[model samples]
Target: MGQVIYKERKNTNSTKWDDCLEKFGKEDLLPLWVADMDFEAPACVKEALQKYLDQGVFGYYKHSDGYEQAFMNWEASHHQYQVEKDWIRFAPGVVPAINWLLHILTNEGDPVLIMPPVYYPFKDALVNNHRTIVECPLIRRDTGYVMDYEGFEKSIVEQGVKLFVLCSPHNPVGRVWKEEELRKVMDICKKHQVYVISDEIHQDLEMSGYHHIPTATVGDYDEILVTLTAATKTFNLAACQNSIVIIPDAKLRERYDEYLTRIRISGGNSFGYIAVQSAYEEGAEWLKELLGIIEGNYRYLRETLEKELPKVWISNLEGTYLMWIDLGAYVRPEDMEKVVRDDCGLAVDYGAWFGSGENETFIRVNLATRRENIELAAERLIKAIK
Candidate 1:
């Protein structure tokens, strides 16, 4: 595989670049806010898409047996999780699948639990659908964030929490959860009979020296667990809108299928199917190179920020391309926007957006861009802070 160069995405209808002004209110800011990468999709994915386009038929499509096989093979080979073909189901995106799960699994006003400093959508899925959100914030340690196993179980029992959304290889603060940690969580949720939706969307983007363990692989909690994953985040095919939901329990699968039927979400797009199949089947080498670039970017940002802006502390990035930084010492929560946006001219995901509350001086930066972009952003931040 050859080296993949970063492409210019400013005028390419990219939400991360093209819509920065509309989203962040800054037209000239360097965007490191969105989760999507600036890198192009793998050559195999592009080739498959082009082949489909050349056919010139935009009619309805169906997933072939090869699609399911590709997904199953990828899970087994990459993550060491043996997923059966029958367990696989389709959805346009992980967030949408989450929303659907919210509707089907829990009742209105029932408490749904999430760990904060978590992916914001977990909260939104509950609030938007009128479900009560039970927050069990992860304990922040000097090493990194860890699951509050005691607090987590207590909340589920005390709040009568029916569902839990687990962000494996957690977002913002990147912590690829250990097997012991996941086992404890499974044990707790099992004792409480709480259903878990493990969102492993960032599973494939693990940094060096860390192995991402699938939640279901921890133990036999199939009756109470569902894993949501996608290639879009891994392969930069978010626009293709493809994700996989794996349910091992027959009863749970039936319930979810019934709900999809009720909502009339029977099938996914043709391109999504093709892209997912192509990515899983032929994009491994490209993924390896991408992970190395992301790890390099993370190291660059960490070194640059620590040396120049000593007050700012960057969390250890174990997984995902999002780097969580604490700028509390140098900037106040109330003035973070002005400093980062106006002074630094850098658009980043403010900590508060990820449910950090008033202690909003943390920022999540995207490290999935070119090295030059990373260097430029660091220089601007260091200069601004000084």
Candidate 2:
């Protein structure tokens, strides 16, 4: 059963692979960089897409009851998050919604806080909207990552930052936010009247023993918290291009509607509705099995790299199919970055990709592919680094 299948991604024009050749003058590299999985999307999503194609009508669309039902069913069954239908609204992608939320809430030059070596997109979204970003970087203990709440609170108070973007099951770092941790951050934000934007797209990718608690789960009094999630990462549905902005309070949703309407970003495409519904409804079993595969890959990679490349440390992953490898002990951070890209012919997401000086000597590798693929890439990396 561990016979990792090899599916040829060549000539399919995969952005993670083919685009590197086209964009960076290289195509032969093993791509373990982007977040999307190499596995095929669940069958039901394909079937749904096919049905719409069979119908042969592509037109402007509005989200409807079926769409709402899909989200409701999925959230209840898989996450147990129990989101109401009316509470969810559509956006093209989570990044877009991040920018939009910043726009609706903050003014120019106002400070927005984030914990870095977090998501690169968080920094990008803030910069694009002309807001100043205050990075209260997380502190990594011997066992795991913990929030720098003292630093975060200081930033909030000193900068008069009106907003903070929280990345749970944090990208690159892969620590799922514990409930107590979430409570602390939320309480601080509550005290400061700071708006929190929780990017929870990886909620569904939690590993065993870890649960993703929506920032909204703690209390109903706060109108400032908005949780952003999508079927994209979990169901391999990014190409479908839709996300849900969950606003528990009605007035917050009203502000969202106003902002979305002016730009005509109110709903989604016909197939976005179909793909999300199909994924949430029919893709649970597939997801469970996929998570098992991902966890196994994480273990295998960690053991292999630790035993063979002892100097390189593969952090114990608590969530997501991503691995953050501490390569600094092996080589200079910059040289490690170049060696992975050049000598190994492996284009890993360099430490610099997450943010300057944030993930220095730390590179992220997306392991959401067949175990054989991951193993071969690891071997190549070992050979190159050696």
Candidate 3:
């Protein structure tokens, strides 16, 4: 583990800080809504970017074997998932990749399935690309969320689904999917002959006891599965705009590559390539320390809120730095924005944005910040709700 440092980011044009007035309609609240970190990029990534700057040659970028090889090696070593070089495609970000994949995998008005409350962008991609959105909401348990396999299959068959977008180590409700769970879902998709896109952007953010299973590694569904992941989330390099799209099936890769070529999309910028390669090669220790910090922050928030607001439903943190808490007991759904933002003075991702109307009283808090921020958020909730 390495030393973790927290820095101020209010005036740096940060979406989390500077855009609070635009997004949350509040300027003075503690910003904890967005997914990016308040910590600096790993020391190694910064040094590599600095080296690129010192050279000062801003020319057109060419493809690099080192970038893809570094990512492949990282995936093989961390997740035990070996990827061949030819299967790789570069995207500026996961969201854009999802949109492109939707266009390639299905026709207009074709149905695509997702599990919600989920990462909202999945729905956005489907809608933006003129595809029908089919949702099989995850079954909520007192322990955590579970896949509703029967319902998922039913939705696929009834809706005439062509694609399924999966959120591995799901966002909002953080359960790192077990191997058995992945296999069950994959089996259902295989039975339905549906194409699957596993958005594994948060695969590396597992907590102390949890492990992320690459969906393709659990079975022989490679022909149907396309994996989307990145070092950006692990290394807080979102601004660099680099992500990896792994297509194990050659035909699918060919179609995706052709789509890129047709759209005149070559690759990401030079900085994105350099930053991602450096992060994948030298960021393991930094990520380990980050997971520890996030775990501690989650413990502090859960313990304090559970002790004070006894009926609050705080989902168990299995992965990702986001904590999902159901404040329905303390505040009515209609009063959520007033209580959480206006009264508590904290910015958070509203639950309604992530799902149907049922989760309106829930709030997702970003935990990848100074422990003090987590403390302040907890203190505010306790004071406002009690």
Candidate 4:
């Protein structure tokens, strides 16, 4: 019981669990939709954050040399991508960084491309920033979701797409883009001079065997790619609101750098910088353990569905703890979001809102929670499905 208490999120205003009723318009639903996990951050991270908090002097701060080195070391050691300290630029979060990219790079009505059934925000970010969205939805095949390079190539030209916002280890539908896939996309982007802004925030949460391939590594087209990532997702540090836009090309970096400065919004939050440095420096083993827990939860859900609710379909998840459940078998035209909330008491992302067809009835569940909660949610869902 005490072990479970360690991960206490109650009263923390935890967006994933604590405040879901306000978000989904219901009070008693089990929240499993958002990507954040329910486990306690590593002891090392808590200690580091507390050390700063105890100082009691909260003021504006900048990225120290150690903070920059943490980025360099983690990228090289974990993902095998070598990045110089100068390349990493701070942002409040990756989504905000995406919005900023739209404003800085594209003029009004310039098209920004995204592959859907994605994170959903990709579309919102474009529309809110006054950029048109060009969709190149991933091709679902036996091997999993693919780039649909042929459709993608044609769209890049047809839409006159200036920027391609890509999700590596794609969300909702979890397929980590292989190096070969990246090579092809990068080549196409280079051919058309389309700037590639990759949201690699989930880069660190990959399941055991699959490794994340950095877009900046695939080709010599240095200036064209700006990779966005952070410790926010990895360590549950979103409250710190820290994200890094890794800009390898100095000239391109300078353009964004100048824009961020003019707005006075680029410095990022003080706690974010502090947390990221500490998480990378001492939290690797804890992350490894956390991955094991997440993988187990995934396996449990799969087995439960197979044995108890064989009709439901689950996407073959490769990276991230987010699970996409295909509910096309059970969806009605009007009661899509209602069925899950009322019948099952499970809160999940409606697939229709993610630019998928109405027939593609699906939902997303996050598995970064305790094993007990996972079982309870699955049991409740199995009853609902029946």
Using lDDT, give the best candidate's number: 3
Model 3 superposed RMSD (Cα): 1.0
Off by over 4 Å in 2: 1-6, 22-24
Instruction: Report the Cα lDDT for residue 181, model 1.
Output: 95
Could you tell me how far off, in angstroms, the CA of residue 338 lies in candidate 2 after the best superposition?
2.7
Models 1 onward score TM values of 0.98, 0.95, 0.99, 0.95
Question: What 10-residue stretch in candidate 3 is worst by lDDT?
Answer: 1-10
What does candidate 4's lDDT look like per residue over 1-386, in tens digits? 23211376766788876776787888667778888878776677778879988999887666688988987899999989999877878888899899888877789899888988888889998888788889988876653678889988899999899999999879978788899999998999999999988999999888877989888888787868889999888887778888888888889988998898888875866677878899899878888888888899999998897788777778787898898887666666467666788887877777776776742577888888888878988887777667
Residue 210 displacement in candidate 3 (angstroms) = 0.6
| Error of model 4, residue 53, in angstroms | 2.2
Q: Rate the local accuracy (lDDT) of all candidates.
A: 0.91, 0.83, 0.92, 0.83
Q: On a 0 to 1 TM-score scale, where does candidate 1 land against the true structure?
A: 0.98
Instruction: Provide the lDDT at 3 for model 1.
Output: 52
1-386 per-residue lDDT for model 2 (tens digits): 32222356767867887778765468788888888888888888889889889989787766568777888777776667788877888788999999999988898898999887887889998888889989898887765678988898999999899999999878988898888899998999988899998998998998898888777776653488899999999987787788999988888889899998899865777888889888887888888888888998888888888888888866668887789888877768658646777777887777776766636788788989888888997798678767
Clashing pairs in 3: none
Which is the better candidate, 1 or 3, if ranked by lDDT?
Answer: 3
After superposition, the stretches of candidate 1 with alpha carbons farther than 4 Å from their true spots are none
